[model samples]
Target: MRYFLTLYILAIVTLIGVAGFRGDISRKPPIEVFPDMDRQMKLRPQEPNAVFGNERSSQPYVEGTIFRGMPYQDTPINTGRISGTTNWVETNPIELTVERMKRGQQRYNIHCLPCHGASGDGKGITSKYGMVAVANFHDARLVSMTDGEIFNTITHGKNLMGSYGANINIEDRWAVIGYVRALQRSRLATLDEVPEAMKAALEKE
Candidate 1:
């Protein structure tokens, strides 16, 4: 019985030593086992590189390269697709009479008034947000501008304003220009020179 007891104690001690060496023992003080644990903690920001995949390669304008393997289509103003010197349409083909002026007014009110103001005074709701200042359509410099010049400005956009070619069709843009001319005329017209019909119409209202 004594011999058997001695052998059992020896086996238990050997097993415990093996477990401690292999880190299998639990509930031991961590400080005593790993004194350098404080030096092992670290944090790092992730790199900006995207993962490699078919989807990443398919995106357009990725890393400044156009994807989809298609040629870039240049917009009108961006690449001067339309000649700058050439007239957009015939000049002085027909006078901008009252009827054309009325149509132009309607188109301008629908599209331009929100940013250019009903009076072309550069005051619009969007202007309050610090966006590019809209030019006063009634400025003397603008008043002297040719109809074709005005059309080009509207189509190609000047300065901070983007081109309206995509939004307003060519014909409508021309009509708006005619309307702007009429507005300028009205602002500068002498009271005595007002058309009799227009004078009467104003009094009736």
Candidate 2:
């Protein structure tokens, strides 16, 4: 028993020494005596298994699962419409305030500016890549689109655009919409729309 105990201790010491000693650096998985819970009885993404008939690990969401953080609020502000109607809300449901517009401008710069140019001219930096045409906000057709339609487009996305609904929260999305409208106005603002004082200054220049 004494001899066996001595041998066991020596074996443990040897293992510790081997682990601590430096060797030639190479890309290799280290030896694991006990990888506790490292390998679990769970399916990874896209991992094939014969468990289900479909053999897919990823499952669809169960029915009636609302994704928003807050509980379902059946309103045009949250759903962007009057429950069953396809008609869009003519104007933004959120109050048009300077603070909200500022927030919208910040969110737009972070998300929309990559595809829609700062001036909403469809000349964003990413446009140089092989992407489909981005719509210019100043275009008469887009300008004519109702505010709710524009909000729906941002929430669900249009051609060549992906939905931002998941990425941006509901209120921020509205803010972004407001900022987009502001951009359109900046480019399409008529001389009559300018303040008299600003117009006079521009005329002098």
Q: What overall lDDT, based on C-alpha atoms, would model 2 receive against the true structure?
A: 0.83
Q: Which digits, one per residue and each the tens of the lDDT, describe model 2 over residues 51-138?
A: 8788888767789877867644667887777656768887789997999999999999999998888988888988889654898888
Model 2 per-residue lDDT at 76: 80
Q: What are the per-model numbers of colliding residue pairs?
A: 0, 0
Query: Can you give the TM-score per candidate against the true fold?
Result: 0.49, 0.63
lDDT per residue (tens digit) for residues 74-114 in model 1: 43332223344453332422456777668778989988888
Evaluate model 1: give its TM-score: 0.49
Task: Report the error of model 2 at residue 10, Å.
Answer: 56
Candidate whose TM-score is highest = 2
Q: What are the runs in model 1 whose C-alpha is more than 4 Å off?
A: 1-99, 195-205
True lDDT of residue 113, candidate 2:
92
